[model samples]
Target: MNKEISIQLSNVSKTFRTSSKSFSTLRDRLINFYKKNEVKTIKALKEINLEIHAGETIGVIGRNGSGKSTLTKIMSGTFIPDRGGQVIKNGTSLLLNLGVGFSHELTARENIYVNGSTLGLRISEIDELFYEILEFSELEDFKDTKIKYFSSGMIQRLSFSIAIFAKADIIFLDEVFAVGDNKFRKKATEALKQNWLKNRTSIIVSHSTGVIKEHCDRTILLHKGELIFFGETEKALAMYEELE
Candidate 1:
């Protein structure tokens, strides 16, 4: 696994500050002093150490708010670690959470260009993958429509479509295969298979053990910010299932 490390994290930790009260009104920010409860910080991750080699498909699984997305952001270098060091060797594309990197005012087609560019893909590259992305999303009917009018599933379908075709060296996905109808999911499955078969590295965040069991050769577990397990998929999955 350490043959050629694409990413490395050493004792990384991230903490977020929390306010005592939700600031709903301007007056709250203006005069909220003693009315606020004790301010505390949440440790999203602590002492996380991991090494990702090229051509590895690793599955990241944990319950909701188990610091999964936080870890992904940390790994992608979008969110800086407060206490440790990380090195990433290649360009990485990520789908961190729902509703990221899309413009509400733009048409789906325009946003496709925008999102693709944000992922560092050239217009020519996107063009080559354009029809394929559309075909995968099954949203050709809504391609010219504004994204504000798109349903959640539609947004996810298009986002996933663009992400897969962006052509970064490393791909990161969150809760994939949950968008679109069965047909699109089936198509996406094939695309993912092809990507892995080609030796492109990927880290997939999913709730379904089946995704890990079927696609990933390795599994990494994080519980409340610690690296609890890292090993073969079946053994890690077995330990995770026992946590319930």
Candidate 2:
């Protein structure tokens, strides 16, 4: 493993198993009890091979069920790849997805502490950045309010604020630009470009072609759980459009 590579995936794959049975009535249930349930396997990702260097900003683009989110989760350590595959992470990583790693029952202020800790921040570090997070989120007045009471945009703002300050070496963002109103989204995007993405390894999953062209150094395209392309941003975008 190269020390400069922040993330590496080799022959990675993911599959989920589910079972279903039909029993409309008690008699049917009794009759079906002796039969095996129908099982199905969903292959979310297959044979993924990638190597991301430190401080690189990469974009991931795909249509629905194309395995973009699954690949992000695998890179973020939230989902384990299937057997015969390997994932190597060289530094701290954080995944910023809608409503992930947050406690809705907790107040926004409390969630900062909790989410910061989960991102590997110490109490003192979070304390020092607490006001900054509040300001960035533009929710200073709602700090004490429970997250459950916040709108989806508010929660996303808070999450992105905390993620930018978490200081992780690798960051994965899933549809982050879709969050918040225009002004706040612009603020968040600038923060990422100027501060976070400039120095960290970032994998951004978004549907916006403009975002990928603007911020990403490289792009990866996925289709039907397979890696379709990984190269220059413009080329990948072209390939993605062709798939559509």
Candidate 3:
């Protein structure tokens, strides 16, 4: 049987504008009246074309500001590409970035519902997975505690637990392993391999070559918002290493 396409990016590109002026007050603005409010346009992602197959694990590696996160956001539908570009998504997708789509003022229990809904899960479905999420996060006692009071590690644990149960067709992981303690990291890694990533289509962004080599079947390298390579993991890593 042939694998179905899970994601397709056709001539996709993203651009962002930043203003050089920092005029906070009328006086500040008047003082800079003679100077043009210079705005710089940055191409976060240059025309890119790619296809991801169902159940494929892809690793995206790049230097800071190389468009790794930008690409992930575009694929997850959190960011829109420029005009003339099209992003085709065949199934449900989720982007797992730290503290994204979670309410800080709400308790962990409440946030679970928020995140579950955001991931396209019905309330009844989330209810069935609530205890499992709590057990995996090891935060059963802190479920009632507001997210603002939780430490970064604790927050990550909760987020990861919720994601594993999200049951999305495609998942985007952005530096997920960087959070939490060593022990928790090990647990998370095990859970990811044994449960979350099993037969799931996923795109992972990380600086760690070991992670890419271990989990990804193929790797994509980006440099200065341009796609440089997309092929076997070994060759992609070699190309990425040459830039350092």
Candidate 1 clashing pairs, residues 3+ apart or interchain: none
**TM-score, one value per model:** 0.88, 0.92, 0.90
Give candidate 1 regions above 4 Å deviation.
22-37, 85-91, 96-99
Over 154-216, each residue of candidate 1 has an lDDT whose tens digit, in order, gives 898888878766667777777776767888788877876786425777888899998888888
Give the C-alpha miss distance for residue 174 in model 3, angstroms.
0.6
Sequence-dependent TM-score of model 2: 0.92
Model 3: lDDT equals 0.90
Model 3 worst lDDT run, 10 consecutive residues: 19-28
Greater-TM-score candidate between 2 and 3: 2
lDDT of 1 at 154: 89
Q: What is the C-alpha lDDT of each candidate?
A: 0.79, 0.90, 0.90
| Candidate 2 residue lDDT tens string, 120-201 | 8999999999999999999999999999999888898899899887768888989988878998888888888877788788
